[model samples]
Target: MTSTSSTFIAGLEVGHFTDPRRPTGCTVVLARQGAVAGVDVRGAAPGTRETDLLAPTNLVERVHGIVLAGGSAWGLEAATGAVRWLEEQGVGMPVGPARLPIVPAAVLFDLLVGDSAIRPDAEAGYRACQAASPATPAEGNVGAGAGAVVGKIFGIARAMKGGIGCASVTVDGVTVAALVACNALGDVIDHDTALPIAGARTLDGLRLLDSRRALLAGEAPRPLIAGTNTTIGVICTDAVVTKIQATRLAQMGHDGLARSINPVHTMSDGDTLFALGTGAAGKAPGMMTLGAMAAEATARAVVRAVRAAHGIDVAGLKLPSLAELGRA
Candidate 1:
């Protein structure tokens, strides 16, 4: 299989189009030839498109692409641009002379972190698709992770900047890769050391605040006014699998989220995960082994998102990156 940095799956092309002006953007995962796919949405306030089509009982056996973007529900429009691009390439389910691309999408609430009036649109999505390639995807403060922030349990004032992250692992002959946009309502932690790496910060911006501890102490701040939060991502592999297995892979992917983020899948979060199989690898691993590997990759991706992030000042409000905070 053709290998891209952090992506070992063949027939998969990853790309992103970022707008630092709005400080938001979109990421596109294109499988022009189509690939088996599945989805799992665990958050109570998710914004997603065409997720039902990925059900094992659905008639569609494969999907053309997946879109992850910022702008909350408004970001969903980005999928249309991806669809249009795929259609132009003659990739999709044939209906007549034209083929309709099956593009599923999900979005995170980054409106509050950037120019709220400016959100990702169809044009942004099309551009992302046009940039698709089997190359190492750019991480941190790009694409859907551009305006992402985490640790909102104490409100946006205490939240830290979040971004995109990716990781991959090879088990037997199968390769599993995960890409994530970290925008959540809680803090991000390092699973290996069980230490808080990023999230809410003290008012002085000198130390990390334990969100869960604060909430338990009845000092939780009111929710932010602008929008809810979410963490959305995709997991791709070269193992052949049925839709049922793919769905299981997505569920396991959530285990990774749980490992890295505190207070995840909250009511204010729209966490969603999608899994795709290219069927390029010679054989598939057992369900248990595949799911376990997916979880590990997902966890690593979440940490990388914050670690790769750089601080930015938006609208006179300075949001610090994990690296900067570590220095302080």
Candidate 2:
């Protein structure tokens, strides 16, 4: 038997489509049997699709898939491909003669790192769905994390490489898992050690420059640009939850971000989290317990994202990873 992460909820599959042309791509999470979904957008600038319908008051209580992508707003197109793929698989909300798939999506900015013209499109999304698997997805410098960067408070030149990561926590039979694409304006901290693992670098690009402490010391940061940075992700749980409960779970998921990502949810970053309740375990842990696990999983995933990243030099831009800096 193969061992899986405690955060890996049964019956859910993850897939990625990375563009070889550059570090820009998309990730898709499929719940073919459908699952209750909710979302919370904490960042001021967000790029998303079908988010309004996830509100507790909306008619749609479940979503078949969720898409996280890079390439800024244009990456949302990946969700369309996911919808088409689901339709072909005969998985969706039954409505009359049609089986319309509901797939909400969010994207991060990575146009400056490489070829902005070669972003993920509908075909890329379809290919991601084709590669869906139950195994834990690969982390760092793939999918939406391909072009992701962090510690942009000092601008891209001194920023560190960011990537995708997944983590899960379990209490009794209940499990909560998270997958994060780290592209923020600040540093990723180790929640347990209270130390910065990755983020902005010193002027010489040889050491860590804690963004929060720098801001507190009255240091000036780069000019803010909305939607140029973001941290987008998804949360999954095996415990039972209603749509409203899922929304609250997503809100709690931000607690993990606050713990792990310094200067998070700023005006320049569009941090969004989506939650899906598959209820595969038939366990319904108290909201407090479930939320706590969700936060823990999210923070762990955030740190893992940068730790798994690899240094990249492209388009005349060189961003180093934690490994390259000997910080991993």
Candidate 3:
């Protein structure tokens, strides 16, 4: 049987730990039974851990969990917590005498969104694991998306709130799903309508500014430092796949980003995607079919991210939601 909820993949659980003090936190996706995994990094500047092990030639074939976090590189500590929690649960790759949790993680730069000092840490990551569930994950201004913002082409003052979103598709009893934390450097568009949904605003802060067209028109943008933006996500499927195929799935997942996010994969962004194959359904769809489903799920998740976000007004930072802009 297939789940009606898009986020419910067969063999994965999702969790988030958002810092109450500031807009910084972490999210964890657990494959406790172990799943074949691969990763693809499209942006120029990415902060990640244990990604090399996901290479097709690497020794490890499966990962126990994947972490997506905020607080720049410091958020990588969250993965440490997830590792510890998994170890306590006796879930990990069997070492000579001990069980070592295999967790690969990625982080986005959210330091500028709130108090940089209040970033996700080992404890935050542990809490996120404790909150893991199979139900649909909470979206918008939560998890890694709490501190996320978009459309920085004009600067922070003209940016909109970015967030996390999830979607899934099932074909022939094989399920594929995606969960994304959207913190892009450009505008988010409604793929169906081809209109800007959230992103850079006019200097007057009254209307949406089409970032792609504006950039093409040679409008000078504010100086955007590297590592200031990113969009991180995970693609999961019940279909069996090899590490190489999983990597290709991650690569195709980027198509979803390109479809919904303008000016994606910029030098300042560290866009990364990870793919997990659980083999829960004991079904192996053709690679082409799986990739197409992945792309579609990813694109829908990206659009849902901005639409689900709420306006942010705290600590002297104010990023409006699509609703606030009358576009929701």
Candidate 4:
């Protein structure tokens, strides 16, 4: 079940689009008024849009837009469409119509998942804007996750489908939530228990937890090797935070990935996280409090992406969901 946007409901509006043919799409998020934001970078091969602005410590933004798209680096054009729509509505930094609406974005390496030629564009971004709602948002293989894959050690031939996911919890009177698109090179594990949640399943239908082991055992990472690229989208939230704090939050959020994904942020991977605040808090909220909540939520989101996915097959291995395992 999806929840609406409210302080009681994480206070964030969400939207998304999916394409099986392009096998890649996007997820967009918008916050209530007066929300400060930032970002963190931790991927070996990242293709992003509008990250520098999100990292400045002297900036005081209210509520900007967040976009998660497919098309590798080319898909970045999609953001321009979003900015155009936002500028028309006067949503952005305090720079008037000319420079209003500071839209930040991230992209994944889905070039091989779909038509490398059919990249996401301003039209796609416009469509994404039309599709975005300030309420419930779809999850799973829908949106940017449409072309996502996991355990790409063996490359595209061995990876399984991935998608968008979300989770939230209140800590220290502040709601710190997370949403992620997991297309990683390693397995995503349980944050608290350090157990494999979404990684790889063997031919026998058991979890395959180690890629390095598979490689060390003389197993090729993939049937064929591909170029360096694969990205994850992360959004960590709480009460309003400065751009720098938001960036710090994004940095801290990486701790969650470190705990869960083995061989994470590899040279072939482009992992990034964005942090935002809804500006709805009344009392003081420590960064640690928000950081911890963000970490746990991020880990769970990764698991949800896999468990909610379908068509998870590559070569002779199958990555089924908890539903199939009778544990959902």
Where's the lowest-lDDT run of ten residues in candidate 4? 1-10
Please provide TM-scores, in order, for all candidate models, with all chains considered together: 0.96, 0.97, 0.97, 0.85
Model with the higher TM-score, candidate 1 or 2: 2
- Per-residue error for 134 in candidate 1, Å, reads 0.4
N/CA/C clash count, model 4 = 7
Please identify model 4 stretches exceeding 4 Å from their true place.
1-11, 32-34, 58-63, 96-99, 200-209, 216-220, 223-229, 312-328
Candidate 3 segments whose C-alpha is farther than 4 A from its true place: 1-7, 326-328
Q: Evaluate all candidate structures by whole-model CA lDDT and list the values in order.
A: 0.89, 0.92, 0.91, 0.68
Q: Model 3: per-residue lDDT, tens digit, 99-216? A: 9999999999988886788989999999999999988889898999899999998899899999998888889989889999999999998877878889999987878999988999
Candidate that beats the other on lDDT, 2 or 3, i.e. the better one: 2
Candidate 1's TM-score reads 0.96
Give per-residue lDDT, candidate 2, residue 105.
97
Best by lDDT: 2
Judging by lDDT, tell me the better candidate of 2 and 4: 2
Error of 1 at 123 (Å): 0.5
Clashing pairs in 4: 17-143, 26-144, 35-62, 92-101, 153-221, 154-221, 154-222
Task: For residues 123-158, write the lDDT of model 1, one tens digit per residue.
Answer: 999999999998768899999999999888887877
Question: Distance from true position, residue 5, model 4, in Å?
Answer: 8.7
